[model samples]
Target: MITRIATLAAAFVLFALPAAAQSLAPYKDDLFAYPATLSEADGGAYRVVDYREMRDVNERDEVPERRVRKQYISLGVRSQQQEMKLGTQRFVAVGTQQGASMIVLYLHGQGGSRSQGVNDFTFGGNFNRVKNLVAKAGGLYLSPDFTDFGDGGAAQIGALIEHFSAQSPGAPVIVACGSMGGMLCWKLASDPLVAERLGGLLLLGSLWDESFLKSPAYKRKVPVFFGQGSHDTVFPVEKQEAFYRKVRGKSGNYPARFVRFESGTHGTPIRMTDWREVLNWMLKS
Candidate 1:
């Protein structure tokens, strides 16, 4: 009887071994094995394909071209007395200097000028990196100064957009603002008319809360790109992350991206050579 019982126990162990092995197999494969490749026969040869891998490669290779055609236009709008009290108001249009598909309205940060400083609020003398980048991306750049430190400047921009629309109907407009200008950009983005008139919104160093994002107007329209510095002293990464999380959670279908730079201040320097990357993303969006 003892011999028979021992033999039965050994048999049970053998049966259980394969089941245990099978249970662990998937975990091992997930960690170590290359994802299974799908193949299809084309003619006489089998072609192995992976759609995700292809997309990654395509995105990686995407870079904007170096050659850019630029044209400058002087845009002047009448300012109210209140606006004049804030600061000088002027609008400059920069484009391929020829036929362009999209128009980009650029707003500088606090203490920023259209002619001076890089995109990040850093003072790089005589460096208009943002304008050059926009030009390379095949989009027209329009830089406007707000009457009072970029506050209530959206009205001026709206007027300009209306005037431009009268001349050229059905042109796509994109709003790009950094820091304080971002405030105005958000305001314009929430407007129904502006939403219909504009194509997308790009905000750098934006200092707004989730309440602004919760607006139904912004949710229905406007694809936004939010870029922030991870080590930003003025705008901490935690706050940005929290705001992004809220936006993502609220709007499941919104086309919004939050990119965190490894190292930079309020405004990161926009290198002309790096315009390719910026242009590629802008054009693709």
Candidate 2:
């Protein structure tokens, strides 16, 4: 049965990839036309852009006039004299403006920036819709660019949580990640500090290998929502199901839920919408 499911999953992946590519072609140009300048509240120079505006530009073929209500934050440490230089990390925070009810920390997939799987700086048209949805749901969205293309471990995510918590106190935090970020979420949820502050976790298209989940220190107590494409090529259905089974066995009363989208491919539109469902679940939780 597992072999049959795997073969069918492979076929679905093959069929879904090219169809997704064609659907994404129309909004490709809005990715890089973001606004060039932003003045921070602390009198610092920061570049800001509305990812939704970029998407509108892609769909309409022109940059739309809109107020710059939110700013994209770039966080990193630069080398000083006789010190090694770590590369800068880029992240976008939507709902940083007033009236945000909660704070959400987002980690993107492999080779994806802190935009949380959306490339508004390149291809536009509702690319960053999840962030906007969180904001509309009265929450602040915080995403961080991890070290080495999101290959950074739990420490990076922890640092981002601390920084955002310091910036906005008393706001409940929810952590969300996709693909490699899902692995990071798993690692972070195990930490006591993270567990103390985190209200929920959302994992999208996660690659949670069996060995990783079986580790002794990887117990997660918070509610977790996991969504994946039924046809993900990178992480097949059998592997995902095996990982889910392991997690279910290891954690007691973990409140974990899984949804598999039919005919979905890795990093495709269906995958992106699955993320939106994750955000919705987080908000309700």
Output the number of the TM-score-best candidate. Answer: 1
Per-residue error for 90 in candidate 1, Å, reads 1.2
Segments in model 1 whose C-alpha atoms lie over 4 Å from true places: 1-88, 96-99, 117-138, 149-151, 214-217, 250-252, 269-285
Q: What does each candidate score in C-alpha RMSD? A: 26.3, 18.3
Query: Model-by-model lDDT, in order?
Result: 0.47, 0.48
- For each candidate, give its TM-score against the true structure: 0.58, 0.57
Backbone clash total for model 2 is: 6
- Tens-digit per-residue lDDT, 179-247, candidate 1: 777777777766667767666666676676554565544666456666665556877867876765566
**lDDT (tens digit, per residue) of candidate 2 on 1-285:** 001111111111111111000111122123323223222211221112122323333343433322211222111100000111122444555543233356677677777765433343222233344444444444556666777423365776676666656555655577777676777776766666766667667666677745445432345445566556667788775677566656655533444566554445564322233344344444444
Candidate 2 has what TM-score?
A: 0.57
Root mean square deviation (Cα) for candidate 2? 18.3
For model 2, the run of ten residues with the poorest summed lDDT: 75-84
